[model samples]
Target chain A: MHKHLLLGVEAIGQGAIDGGMSGVYAYPGTPSTEITEYIQENELAIERQLHSKWSANEKTAYETALGMSYAGKRTMACMKHVGLNVAADAFINSAITGVNGGFVLTVADDPSMHSSQNEQDSRYYGQFAMIPVLEPSNQQEAYDMAREGFALSEETGVPVMLRITTRLAHSRAGVEYKPVLDENQLSMPQDPRQFVLLPAIARRRYKSLLDKQASFVKLSEASKYNQYTDAADKSMGIVCCGISYNYLMENYPDEACPYPVLKISQYPLPEKQLKKMEAECDSILVLEEGYPLVEEQLKGYFAGGTPIKGRLDGTLPRDGELNPDLVAKALGKETYVGIQVPSVVANRPPALCQGCGHQDAYEAMNEVLADYGKGRVFSDIGCYTLGALPPYETINSCVDMGASITMAKGAADAGLIPAVAVIGDSTFAHSGITGLLDAVNEKSNITVVISDNESVSMTGGQDSSAYGKIESICEGLGVDPAHIHVIVPLKKNHAELVKLFREELEYEGVSVIIPRRECIQRASRRKRNISRHANH
Target chain B: MKSNIILAGVGGQGILSIAAALGTAALENNLYLKQAETHGMSQRGGAVVSHMRISDKPIASDLIQMGTADLILSVEPMESLRYLPFLSAKGYLVTNTTPFVNIPNYPEYEKVMEEIHKLPRFIAIDADRIAKEAGNARASNMVMLGAASPFIDIDFAKLEDGIREVFARKGEQIVEINLKAIRAGRQFSEENK
Candidate 1:
C-alpha cells in the first residue's frame, strides 16, 4: 500500500529494502541525502542493524559496500552523481575485479543545477565502466528495479548502476505492490584474487566482461520493467525513459496519444523495442530526463530521413530536467504559459532555520573572535554554513563537505590568525575526522567549532556518528583534552559559549569547541512523542 | 476526469501542502496521481510551485507545459499572474487578493494589487483576512487551499484529512486552529457563491 509523494532519494532506499538488500553504504549530499536518512529512520532496518552508516565520504562508502559484497552479501552503495567523481578510481577497478556478491550503485542526478555544482549525469559513468544501468519511472518501479539490478549484477558478475533524476528521486505515485525476494547470503571471499587487481588478471576479466555484453542486451529485452504499449492510433510513437514517461503520459490523454508508447526503465538500449517503435510510427519523440542517451542510440538506428526530435536539436530543453508541459509541447500541444504574477515574490535565499543551534554557535564565535579578521572562519556544508548568510555572516569559506576543517588548516599554515572551522556533528563524521587528524599531525593552529546538533537536521535528521562521541573523537585524534571544550548551545548560555569560543580562538595549537544541543525540530518532535506515549 | 494543476506562491506559503492535499484527494478518489516540487533554498521567499496531475489511469511526469494547466491556484495574486502562462485556454485562475511585495523593484505594493485586479479570468479571495478570521494569521495557505478545492475534482474531506494528519503531531490546539482555518476557507468560498 503506497501513499504520499515519497521523495526520489527516499524511494531509492525503500527500493533497496523492498528488494531484499543486506546492507547500504552512503555519504550524504543534497538531492541524494535522503536514501541513507530513510534507512536510519526505518525501524525494521535499524533493528536489523541493516549496515547503514554515513561513511567518511563517497570513497569510504564505496569501499564499505565493496567489503559487504566481498562477504557474499547484496549491498547497495549510493551517492549524488558528483560523489561518483570522488569514488571513480575504486569504482572503475571494481568493474574489472568483479564482485563476490551482488552490488548495486544508485546515483541521484540533479539537473537544472538544483542543489548541485554541475548537473552531470551518472549514466555516463555507467557507460564508461561498461555496466548495465537501470532508471525507474516511479517509486514502485524504483523498488522493483532495485531488486532486478542486484540480480543482474550477480548474473553478470558486475556492479549495476541505477541512475535517477531529481523528479524521479522526490515524486510519489502509487506503485503496484510486490513481494521481497531474498538473496543468497554466502560467506566471505576465500580467494584473494577476487579483490586483488593484478594487471594480468584484470585484463582477462575486462575481455570477459566485453564477451558478456550480448547477454546483457538480451537481458534488457526480457526485463519486466521495460514495456511497449500500443496506442489507439499507431501513426506516431513516443519513447520515454525514467521520469520523462510520467510527463509524457500525464499530458497526452489516451485519445490524444494514439501513437504507440515505449516505456523504458532498464538500459543497454533494447534494440528490438526501438526498432519496433520506429517501424510503427511516422515520427518519434525521444523523452528522457537528463541526457540524450536514448536519443543518440535511436539516431544511429534512424539512418534514413525519419526525423527524431529531443535534446540534440533542442526540441526539448538542452539542459534542466524535462516536465510534462515540455513533453506536451513536443507532442504539439499548445503549451500553456501562465501569466507572470506581480513581483510580490521576493528573493529570500535560504538562511539557517530560526533558533538553529548553529546560529547560536556562530554568533558566539563571531563575538568571541572580534579581533580576528572577517575571513578567518571556514565552514563546511550543512546548516552551519548558513553562517555565510546575513546577520550571522561568521563563516567565510564553504567549498564543499568537510572542506572547512582542512581549509582552516591550510589557511592557518599560510599565516592567518585564528583560522577557525565551523562544521556540524554530522559533517564531522561525514568527512571532517580525517581533516581534524591532519590538523593535529601538522600541529596547525586551527580551531574547529564542531556544531553538534545531535543529528543531521539539514538533510532531514539522520543520526550523526559524532552525536555522542565528538569530544572523544577529538581527543582520539591527538588534540589536547584540555583544549576540547563542550558548551551548551543556547542564547541564555551565550556568555559561557562565547568564553569557550574565545579560548579556542586564542589557542596556539589545535583546539576544538563542541557546542552541543538537539535540533529544535527534533526536540519538539521528541516532546510530542513523549507526551503521546505518556497519554497511551 | 483528468486534470493538471499548477500551484504557485512564495516560499513558506504552503504551496507544497496544497499539492499534497490534492494528491491525498486523488488517493481518496482512487485516481492516479503524480506531483513534483521545487524544494530547498527556493522555498525561502523565492518563487515556489508544485505540478500535480490527476487521472483515472496511471500518470507519468510531474512537469506540465505552458498553456496546459487545467487549474492555476495562486496563493498570492502576483504568483498567480506570474504562472498564468501555464493555464490552459479554458482554465480558471484563483488567487489571493492580498499583495505580498517583498521584491526589490516592486517597492510600491499597491501597484501589484492594481495589476492583479485587472485580470479577466481571475477570482480573488482575501485569504489572509480569512486566515486571520479563522483565528490564526498563518493559515492563509490553508485558506487558499480551501478556495482552490471547490474548482477541482479534489475531495474536501481528503484535504481536511491531510491538514489534520500534518498538524496533528503539533498538538490538539494547532490541529484545532488549522481545522478552523480550513472551515473558514470553505465557508468564505461558499458565501461568495
Candidate 2:
C-alpha cells in the first residue's frame, strides 16, 4: 500500500527498494541527502541488510554502487549536481563498462544554486555518457521512474541517470507505491573481461556504447513519459520538460491548452515526438528548468527553425527556477503585482546561531588577524562558511569542499605569508585532509583552523564523518604535536584563543589550531532527545 | 473548492510544522494536496516560504501563482508582508504579531504591524503570548495555525485532530498543550473577526 503523503525523496527511496535495489550509496548533499537517509531509516531496508550508508565522497559512492552492480545486485548512487563532477570520471567510464545487474545514478540538480555552488544541469552528463536519462515531472513520476529505472538499465546493460531539479526533489505529494521486489541474488558477469578497461577492450566497449545510442533513442520515443498532446490551436506549440510541464499546465487549469504540447521526461530528445509537434505547430516554446539544453538544440545555429523561444530568446528569464507566474507572463497573461515592500524590511541573510562556536572562533581569529589585514582566510563549505557574513566578515574565499586548505597553500607558496584556512569538521573529512597533507609536505607557512563542531550542523546536524577524530587525524597527517593546538571556543577562552592564533600565524611552518565545541543547535537537540527518551 | 496558501516565516520558526498540520488535515478530508518547501542553505535562518495547495481536484503546479493564494499564513510579522505579492486581493493575511529579532537590523515591531494592518483583510495576533498562556510557549506555531483556521477551507476539528495525530508521538501532554494553544488562537481570531 502507498502512503497518503510522501515526500519526493521518500518516494524515490521507497521506489528503489521496491525495484529490488540491494544497496544505496551516497554522500550527504542538499536535496539528494534525504534519499539515502530514507533508506537508512526504513525498517524493511534494515532487515534486508541493504548497504545504505554515507560513502567517503561522491567518487567512492559511485564506485561502490558499481561494485554492487558487478556482484549482480541492483544498486543506486546519488549525489547533488556538483558531487557528480567529483564522480564524473568513474560515471562516464561506467557507461562503457556496462552493468551486470542494474545500476542507477541519480543526480539532483539545484537550479538557482539553492544550497549548491552552481546550477549546472546533470542532463549534459547523461548525454556525454551516451546513457538514458529520466526526468520525472512530479513526485508520483519520481517514484515510477525510480522503480522502472533499474529495469531500463538492466535491459540496456548500461547505467541510467535519473535527473531531478531542486523543486521536484523537495516537493511533497501523495505517491502510490508498487509492490516490493526482493533483492537480486549475488552473481558475476558472463564475460570475465567485461570489467577490464584496457586500451583494446575500452575501444570495443566505446564502440558498443555508441551502437546503443540508436536503441536508447528508440526507447525514449516509445516511453510513456514522452507524449505529444495535440491541441486545436497550432499557433504556438509548447515543449515542456520535467517540472516545467506542470508549470505550463498550471497556466491553463480548466480547459485544455490550445497549442499542441510535447511533454518530455525521458531524454535523448525523443526526436519523433518533437518532429510531430514541429510539423503541426507554427512556433515552439521550450520550457526546461535548467540550462537551455533543449532550447539550444532546437534553435541550433542559423535560425529559421519554427522561431524557437525560451531562455535564449527572452521568452523566459535565462536564469533561476521557473514558477507559475513566469510561465503565465510568457503566455502574455496579466501577472499579479503585489504591494511594494517597505525599505525598513532589510534583507535577512542566513547567520550563525547565537552561542555558536564558530562565532567565538571568528571573534578570536579576527582579533589576532586584524594587523594582517583582510583577504587571508580561505574557507570551505559548511556552517563556518557563514563567517564570510556580517559582524565577523572573517573569511575571504569559499569555493568548494576542501578548497580552503589547498587555496591557502597556493597563496602561501606565492609569498602570501601567514595564509590561513578555515574548515569545519565534516568538510575536513569530506575533502580537506588531502590538501592539508600537501600543505604539511610543503611545510607551507600557513595557519589551518579546523572549527570542530563535532557534527555536520549545516545540513540539519547529521553525524560528522570526523566526529571525535579531528585531533588524531591531524596528528596522523604528520603535523608536529607541539604545533597542533586544540582550544575550547568560549567567551572565557577568547584571549587565550587570540594568543594561540597569533602564535600560529607567526609560525614559519604549517600550524594547526582546532577550536573544538559542539554545535549549539545540535547540542540542544541532543539534550531535548535525551530528556524525551528519559521521560519515555 | 481549492485553497492556495503561502506559509511564510524565518527559517526554523516552525512554518513547516504549520504546513504539516494543514497538509494532514487536508489529506484526512480526502483533498488533494501539493506542498513545495524550501530546504538547504536558506534554512540557516533565512526567509523561507512553502506553497501549499489543497483542492478536490488535482493540483498541477507545486507552486501557487502570484495573486492566487487564498491565505498568507505567517509565523513572523515581517515575513508575512514579504509574500504579499503571492496573496490574492481577497486573501486573508493571518500572521503572528511576534517579530523574530534574529538579525540586528530587524525593523520596528510597530512598523511591521502598521504595514500588516494596511491590508484589506488580516488577523494579527500575539501567538507567542497566547501560546504561553496555553501552557506551552513552543506551541506558538499551533497558535498561528489556529488564528488562520477560520480562513482555511478545512474544518477546525480536523485541524485539531491533525495536531493530535502529528504530536501523538510526543506524548499526550504535548498534544494537549498544542490543542489548547490552537483553541486560544482560534478564540482570539473569532472575537476580532
Docking class of 1: acceptable
TM-score list, all predictions: 0.84, 0.98
Give Cα distance to truth, residue B51, candidate 1, Å.
1.9
lDDT of each residue in A94-137, candidate 1, tens digit only: 88778877899999898986666678878889878888889888
Model 2 pairs whose backbones collide: none
Candidate lDDT values, in order:
0.78, 0.90
Query: How well does candidate 2 score on lDDT at residue A217?
Result: 88
Q: Residue-wise lDDT of candidate 2 within A1-536, one digit each (tens)?
A: 43558778778998898899999988888889889989999898999989897887888899999999999999999999999998999999999999997999999999998797889999999999999999999999999888888999999999999999989988899888778887789999998889899999999999999998999989999999998899898999999999999998999899898889999999888888888877777899999999999999887731686789899999999999999889998888888866666666778888898899999999999998899998899998888888998999999999888999999999999999889999998889989999999988988998999999988788778788788888899899999989999899999999999999998899999899999999988999999999989988
- Candidate 2 residue A349 Cα shift, in angstroms, is 0.8
Worst 10 contiguous positions by lDDT, candidate 2 chain B: B81-90
For model 1, the DockQ equals: 0.44
